[model samples]
Target chain A: MSRMILLTEGMSNPEEAKTATGLLRYRGEEVAAVFDSACIGETAQDVFGVGGAIPFVDSLDGLEADTLVMGIATAGGELPGAWRDIIADALRSGMKILNGLHTFISDDPEFASLAAEHGGELIDVRRPPAGLVVSSNEARNTPCFRVHTVGHDCGVGKMLTALELTTAVRGRGHTAEFLATGQTGIMITGSGIPIDAVVSDFVAGAAEQLVLENRDKEFLFIEGQGSLVHPLYSGVTLSLLHGCAPQAMVMGYDPTRTTIRHSAKPMPPIAEVIGLYEAMANVMAPSRVVAVAANTASLQESAARELLVSLGESLGLPATDVVRFGCEPIVDAVLEERRRVGEGAED
Target chain B: MSRMILLTEGMSNPEEAKTATGLLRYRGEEVAAVFDSACIGETAQDVFGVGGAIPFVDSLDGLEADTLVMGIATAGGELPGAWRDIIADALRSGMKILNGLHTFISDDPEFASLAAEHGGELIDVRRPPAGLVVSSNEARNTPCFRVHTVGHDCGVGKMLTALELTTAVRGRGHTAEFLATGQTGIMITGSGIPIDAVVSDFVAGAAEQLVLENRDKEFLFIEGQGSLVHPLYSGVTLSLLHGCAPQAMVMGYDPTRTTIRHSAKPMPPIAEVIGLYEAMANVMAPSRVVAVAANTASLQESAARELLVSLGESLGLPATDVVRFGCEPIVDAVLEERRRVGEGAED
Candidate 1:
């Protein structure tokens, strides 16, 4: 198995360093260590709490690994100039590099030549195929029970909810697969087109292709991105919603969020968000919001459970902290939607 | 000025050949002739009951022109295999090619080299810049009066409304420039990006860039893309809506339409669609539906007037068919929004 070193230098929090935290929390086996000079001596447990101990390094100088993953997932997906020298040194040292940035390192003539000489591959996770077109509309006709996670805002547990729901379905003796659609999700899954990196027209097409390609799976859990209510990121979100044509959807949101991300306005109520998502979905196909998965990480265990129960009652759907409560409610909805879609297909 | 030939072969109808119809109707000066083997001897007037005669050719042979323009803007933007031979022969003969396809012809090494040798260019009108990211949020702060045209469905007069509104504003001694966001609009203007070709994350960013680029113009008439009610292209529509941070929006719709394009469900009512669009606009910035622009093509003149008057009275906003009747009502609303924004800026 290939081991990887995470480079998260200069990132202040785990959210900014999601690539490292995602691997630490999800795919711990592949992660050898994280390199962040500011928090040199701290372990993953100290930084993110739930994870087991993982070594941290000060710099890239002495780190030797099969792959050096870019653990600092920046907002704009640009390769930082500050990381240029460190990355070039790693490339020269014969370690394959992996990135999810919109900028493909292979497209850089200098880096392309450097990687060629060292015989180390540059894996761009978000670099779409050169000739990708708009959605083919075949996913609209797909029989798979697609359950996508939509959120109130960015960084609101959409990915985690989808992953948990996938696991919950699998544990129930059904074949399930998670569709990764963003950088962090792509990093954790080791496959997916970073949707934000794709040209706008092909975003939905790429998603449809991903869904259509995994037809054998009984349940498809699609990891969502951004918010439909968010101005900057809604294009990608709407594209994903239309692409998969999911019959059921999970509204993933974090508690203590009162507004759209990066703004001061109050967040729309869950019902409104649900209505918008379902309306948008219905525009493409018949769909409904079957459940809500709240991220209770910021709340106490007792408080989280109480809020979840109340939210479930208020929204008229099962709501829970998927991580802490194992996503039983979401899974039940998934099974139900699967049975419904299964019947529709037979007819 | 470089004269261009339109290529609209085997498209069956005028709507399917919008690129040809738009240019023939609007930008007649730049258009030399049209190449459609099926309608070789027919004029634009013969086919669409509009515009004057322009020669239509049967094949690519014996044609001498500076550029060969793609006139059949197909759904999904795929360059058909039918156009392959004609395009290739033109490229070899040193005619620059203009395409609105999602697939970039320049990316083809064979066609690229042939064009290079022949000193001709393959211009992809819908091609967006490579490194575009999310919006910088500056458009939100810009003092310009941003007005965007939205629609109930595609082919319902969004581009026409914006163009007419810009003219109306100009006629009133105000400066307004149209921002073309589609292939037909781009060809009509000889400049403008097809917004759908952009990366999803950058759709709004590009719109912001386009808006910011034309700061001298007091009123920005943004040509809309797909309808938000249409499942397939709603992402682009939403992106445009959020990107410009419009102070005013015009609802462009065909009166006869009752459902989404290529969809079976009856379309949401005008008030409901208006609420949705305004709600989305409010998420980014305080904005509202200023007026309505109806396409009364299928109705008689008297019926069109009755419907327009009723829609205006009920919606409590001015409504008109910008094509048949000039865009005075819509222009008045745009000017009003401009005045409001201008007053706010002064304070």
Candidate 2:
């Protein structure tokens, strides 16, 4: 793994620093520093207390990391204009660029040659693969227990939950793989189709490729995209759901969000959201929501526990704050579901 | 309108024959003939009894239609392997192919040159636009009433409703344009993005461009695909919703089924589905479900009326089968919503 510095600029909070924030949560060991001018004197823990103390710096000068990852994830994943010079500076310093934004740095001939000269690579994580067709339902042939992490809304830790669940399952000596469907997740995993970048029709087909590609894994943990309940992004969510043909799913959401993030639509009841997901899954693939993974960024410890308990009671599924609780419940739920499937197959 | 032939071979009933059947109902004037070998010698009246007399032929020999539109829309939209020779024959016979299938005919060099020789077009209706970015929220600026036709499930008259509503609204002296988001819709309108073909991230961005491009229209009738309740296709549904930032919406559904079509998953109540659409729309553009357009194909004339009446009473919105009752209620509702908005603006 290449040592990298996350460039969040002056953005405040985990929400604005989504790409960087997600990396810090899951790939902190690879991160050498976070260059956010706003929190110059602070560390990752000072801003987001859940992730451990990784140093934060205000300037790019004298940073020893060999790669710089664009840390901001805007609604459209477009690179901020302010970051153009920063990227150029990093290239001059011989640091590879890993960008999860829709705007591809490699698409620029100037930047392409610059990175080439420095022996540094510029990876655009959201580039759609060449020649993707619609799915042929081949994912149905996979025997592994597929667990897709769905969310109640966008930016609700679906990717993080999926990543954590993979690690957690593997810790128990099970081979699990993380299948990413978005730019940020693809950046970390180094493998995944940016489903959103693919034409709408082939989103599921691209997903099938991901599953088929990782068929050898004992468990496949596919990261989810926008929520089926999210008005603007439910299409991607549905396609991914159908594509993965997951036997089980984990529901992820920000517990404090009464409404969809960045919009005023009050979230439907959690029960109703699950009903929608299960209702669709029941048609395409016989899947169940095995657990609820809450993003407890806004909640205190007791508040998060109360929310999880209520979710567990009302939804009758294992519920945990993936960030705060380390995604154990989700992993256990996947294992339980797998065992049930195995026993059913035997019968 | 370009005269075309419908091709629904190896299919049973009108439901399985969605694309061909839908075109017969709505774009009857453009349909020269339909070619379904299984239902040879049967006219549209003989097959469905809705559309007027259109010739049905079993063979491609001496076919006279100027365009051969792929009339069979299967899930994932892959071209049937058996139909490959039929397409090749049509190209040689000098008929342009309007292929909505995910497999593009232009991708084949032989077919591409064949079409070029005949001055015929190989329109891959689902081809995603190159270099699509995520939405920049430009749709928030459109002043005309923007309405998205959302559905209870896929293939439930979302496109047909949007098309009919556009015709209906225009008849009432409002300029309404149907924004197509799929291959079928794109074929009819000669314009549209095929939102499903779009990469997941840019689904909304493509939609915003649609809204932004048609800003001058008095009423923008945006076609929707797949249900927000659909597990496989909801992401595109949500992106279109947010991307358009519609001020009003029309809910589309097939009133016949107790379950999601083809799957065992029970359909959510119409009222709850409407609430879900409204809930999400409320956050983005403060849109309401102005009406419901039900696909009453499975019901008799009397049965359709009964269902619509009960639906209107319970959901408290104007409801009608666009194909059966002619979409008057939906058009009236949209006009009424526009009136309400104008009144509020004046106040």
Candidate 3:
């Protein structure tokens, strides 16, 4: 196993360091340390309070790790200029670099040459696989109960909800697979198509391929990307919805966010957003927003609990933060939806 | 202007040679001849009954042209394997190749090395421009009267409708611009973002940039892509819809296409497809499919006329085959819609 040192730089919050936090949460045993200048003396547990006492360092000065993972995604996935020197230093010392940004480090002349000289590998998790065509609705042939985790924004625990739901479904004695569509999910699960990195025409095709490959699994918790109402990424969101053709959807949302991130566009009402997704999904297959996966990390435990109950009652569906309260309610909803629709009913 | 020989080897009909037909229709003067082994003795006029009298030849034998354009898009935009020797031979003679396929000819090792050694240029029209980020609704700020030509399927004359509408709007003394989104449109109008070629996240962003750059025009007719119900390319369709955020839409459709091309998916009712486009478009902006630009090519002139009138009354929208009749009715509907919404009204 590779001893991974996460390079999160100035990121201290779980929200900002999604990939890092996810790796720490699920693949914690493999993580050696986190390198963040802002949270140097702290550990992963101290910062996000999940990953057990994994130390944080100001630099790679004394860290001994074989792999250096770029542990955060910036708005447009561009490599921050400040990160270049840190990455170069690590690459010179023969450390493999794992990146999940839109910018491929392997394509960078400087980084590529240095890594080549040191016999170090550069793994770009977001680089799409070759030969992807436009989706042909081949996913509809899969006999699994596919449930997608959709959301109101980019980082509202869609992946986390899917991941937790996968675990919860398996605990119920069913074969469940977490279908990763983003970088963090790919990192945790070992393989998944980076949906956003694919050519626009092939986004749906990529999603379809994922479902078909894992057709034997009894259930698939397909990870979602972008909000349907998000100004920039709504296209990707819609493509994934049609491509996956999930029979049931778990709506993920950060209860605190009222506007789209990085823009002044006010969020549409939750019901409206859910309707948008359902209507879009029905374009390809019959589907419904079966439950809500609320990311309530911003709220106190009591408030979060209160919000979950109220949200459930208002939406008339079970709602919960999978990370805080477990994903049992959502899994129950998925299984219930499947039963209501009949086992693998074509209609 | 560079003399061009259209390489449409097996394509003898207009439907199979969209790019060649489009180029012939708009840039016929620059086209020297067409190379289609299947229609060697025929001319463009004899085969398609258009483009005057440009002759079709079997091979590059004795052809004197500076540019060779790959003139057909195969299913999935793939280059047919049989065309390899033709393209390679053309490159050997130092001819510039303009291709518009998902497979980049410039990236093919053999093609790339051949072009490099022979001082030839390979222009991949589908190659997306660099540095596109997620859309931020910057297009909403532009004051131009934006109209998009959406469709029920691919190759159903969305580009033709947009082009003709631009001409009609220009004929009415309005400054109208045809915003290209595909390779044929790009080749016709000189520039455009290949929306499908872009990264999934940047499809809308690219569309936004195109509108922003041409904000000075009084009227902008944006070319559309795949149908909202198209299994393969709906993602591109929806992304383009949201990205352009048109004030009104001219829906392009073939009167005979009862199913999505190449798939078993039944085409939904015209009203339902329109509603789907309207609902998805309204997610970003209040847009409506104001007219139907039907490609009634399969019908006789009289039958086509009757279908157009019936379609118009049934849908309660102006309908016409822009190529057969003028785009006067569609252009009039666009102007009427602009008036109904008021000039650049935000609310």
Q: Score the docking of each candidate (DockQ).
A: 0.60, 0.37, 0.66
Over B189-213, each residue of candidate 1 has an lDDT whose tens digit, in order, gives: 8777678888788899889888888
Residue A339 accuracy (lDDT) in model 2: 90
For model 2, residues A1-347, the per-residue Cα lDDT tens digits are 78889988877577778888778776888989988777877888888764577888877788778988888877767778887788888898888998877788999887788898888789888878887766656675687778899988888888988888898899999898999888788777778888876777678788989999998889999999888766556667778888888889899867677877766667778887887788666556678999998877677788888988998998899999876778887777888898988776421
By TM-score, the candidates rank as 3, 1, 2
**Stretches of candidate 3 above 4 Å error?**
A343-347, B13-15, B116-118, B343-347
Tens-digit per-residue lDDT, A1-347, candidate 1: 77888877788375677777777778888778887778777887888664577777866666658788888666677787887777777788888888877778878887788889998789888777665667766776876688899998888788888887888788989888999998878888878778887777677788888899897787789999899988788878998899888888899877788866666558888898888898788877788898888888888899998999899889999998877887887888878876876776732
Off by over 4 Å in 1: A61-64, A336-347, B60-64, B263-266, B339-347
Best-performing candidate as measured by lDDT: 3
What TM-score, over all chains together, does every model reach?
0.94, 0.78, 0.95
The most accurate candidate by DockQ is 3
Q: What pairs collide in candidate 3?
A: none
Candidate order, lDDT descending: 3, 1, 2
Model 1 C-alpha RMSD vs. true structure (Å) is 2.4
- How many pairs of residues collide in model 3? 0
Could you tally the backbone clashes for each prediction?
A: 5, 27, 0
- What global local distance difference test value does model 2 have? 0.80
